[model samples]
Target: MTAWLPLESNPDVLTKYIHKLGVSKEWEIFDVVGLEPQMLEWVPQPVKSIILLFPISETYEKHRAQEHEKLSVDPGVFPDDLFYMRQLTSNACGTVALIHSLANSKSISLEDGILKSFLENVKDLTPEERGKALENDKSFTEGHHELAKEGQTVADPEEKVNHHFVALINKNGVLYELDGRKEFPIKHGPTTDETFIQDAAKVCKEFMARDPDELRFTVMALSSV
Candidate 1:
């Protein structure tokens, strides 16, 4: 059996790591808590991306296979500029999703920081290669380690869990789901800058509908201050 690393699913932890990496001062993350319209009313506007936490399951595997088949036949569904990556490590999904949200965001400047340096190093590489590069990135991994320690998540390497994180963002007027586990970015449907939250909420509903009986899922967004 393969060993997987552990990660914190708390949005606060994610926000801490985001700042630690010096992604951008303009960007902020808040827990969605609930997906209802009223709950969303509290979130700041001009949201760049939504991050989801879900438990891995056989049903998710089935959905992934179905989505992969569809994407194989219609690769154009995703925008050409979508930054996607395959999660090379089991526990790295959260990092991958966080990076996906930040790296592809135009509202926030990734100009000169650890993230910018990392992105520059892998800009020309394929998504898979980018994942590998991220796995080996010392600065980024060290930050993740520090945050993990702060979160008290460091544990036996043999421990395993099913939780995972993915990001949803709008690019070229389309809503795309960036899951490192997926072979490519999954384009759900059309969405404009103004309506991305509502559209993304609809997609989140679809995800909820996929496994109606399961309730181990969460949604958070990265928005402007």
Candidate 2:
């Protein structure tokens, strides 16, 4: 996936982290890069997927809301939705792709896929209801598109959509979409792993490197560009 990688515990932190790459452009491109602290701790070792947990605030709706429609602080941020918080998360799919490639990871890659919903995971779905949702992808795509655009759109209406904002990798390895965060229900967040399945998956991938290295980093900037 070509979406900008979310390199932190939450996606909102993108407000500052994009600058580390030395890109002179006005915005950041999402893609995979970097290892988990644990992966890096091992050094020179390649990484498995870096599980990135981005804080998705309940107040996100408030920030983009019209003045009168704005949410009240009394209620505080919207209560965190564990489902939304879980699967649909990440800085950028680009970061995922880069990391997958850099670490030589073999996996189905997509930032949105991490957030996409599947009914088997939804607790309330009647078997029929679940089947219905699975057959519909239009509403799903539109929903994700809007969310992603909310954070990537420029203040100036006429500004061209910034290419740096987001990108995606389809199951078939195609650049399927744009704006990573908008790409899912977040309710359908990434699937949880069983310890044994995770271990077996890792066994098939090469995570060991032969040496050690260090690199310095600096923050640059954030823009809707």
Candidate 3:
């Protein structure tokens, strides 16, 4: 398995990488200063998706294992149109999270390029197959490599990265947590386009609550430019 460099949570680098992958300039990634009501109110309207970068601590791992076990037995409802893929390569969670954020966003228009083509080709494939496809895509890999080096602090590809990214998106009026490392998207609860930012913030707070001593969490939103 290939291990690419981990991506920084910086919005400038993320926005540039997405643009290079053919996301229209009309949308861009912005840092979520705070999860409070006043802070969320300052965020640009119509947030397409929310990405949370959190530490993979023992507490989180225990919860994740328990949740996976529970869901494996009783997997709840998720929209058929919800685009998701697993992470087959190491240190690729950032790219996978961005892909989830873009793929599920109906309002964002993708130009004809790597992402557009990849999504079209994998529309009919299963989640594991989609992961393999992304792993073998040289063009996408190259793009990821180039941008991964543009971050503020470049880390070695083989270095251990304790942080992971997951995207929260609203599909068919339900809030789905998309994590490539997970077996399937976790449906949080009911949400609307108008209340997505606030709803996602609540989930983000839960993540923080799990790791109260950790202050490395970063939250970003994909919204209007």
Candidate 4:
């Protein structure tokens, strides 16, 4: 069986691919290099979602298991309209993160394109079903594979990578961690248009805390112009 290959974590590349997926240019993405309050000063306002790129290690797996065991993910607590899906294949987490961000971003209108069509088709399906649909989308799936090949030497399809992307979005006054690999959206805490940056920063920091000695974590945000 062929699996999806990992994508390079380049902001420019990511934004370009996001644009190709039909997200408007008005919905820009900016890098958030630090978790400090000062880092928020330069970030554009009305941040909708925060994307986290981190190394996947045994430590992360342990934390994932622990979090799953300890935290009760009340899927219903999240907004009824939130869009989420499961990662059914390896190396597709980046695409999953992009979808999670775009799907939940209410302000950005998706133009007529593959993403819009895909969303329409999967609108009523369950998360697992949506994932299955994605797997079968040749045009969209192949587009991602092409993007993954740019700006770096393409690795063999069997080669494994340790990094993944996860998105944290605020919807209906609540903060949700939308990880395709997770069974359900994780409710971190309350959030709003005014406080989502700070609220998401807290959750991002907790992810860092889980692997304090690891320094491979990166944080970025999707926001209005």
- Give per-candidate clash totals: 0, 36, 0, 0
- State the lDDT at 50 in candidate 4: 92
Worst 10 residues of 2 by lDDT: 210-219
- In model 4, the worst 10-residue window by lDDT is 70-79
True-structure RMSD for candidate 3 = 0.7
State the displacement of the C-alpha of residue 7, model 3, in Å, after optimal TM-score superposition.
0.7
TM-score of 1: 0.92
- Could you tell me every candidate's TM-score relative to the true structure? 0.92, 0.21, 0.98, 0.93
RMSD of each: 2.0, 19.2, 0.7, 1.8
Per-model CA lDDT versus the true structure: 0.81, 0.27, 0.94, 0.85
Clash list (residue pairs), candidate 3 = none
Candidate 4 has an lDDT of: 0.85
lDDT measured at residue 45 in model 1 versus the true structure, 0 to 100:
86
Candidate 1 regions exceeding 4 Å error are 1-4, 152-156
Deviation of model 3 at 112, angstroms: 0.6
lDDT of 3 by residue, 64-101 (tens): 99999999999886778999999999999999999999
Among all candidates shown, the one with the greatest lDDT: 3
Model 2, position 130, has a per-residue lDDT of 34
Per-residue accuracy of model 2 over 1-225 as CA lDDT, tens digit each: 112222332234342322321222333322223333343232221222223222223333243243224323332222122111111322233332222221122232223232223322443643234324433434433333333344543223233322222221221211121222332311111223222122322321211211112122111111124
Candidate 4, superposed: residue stretches over 4 Å from native: 70-76
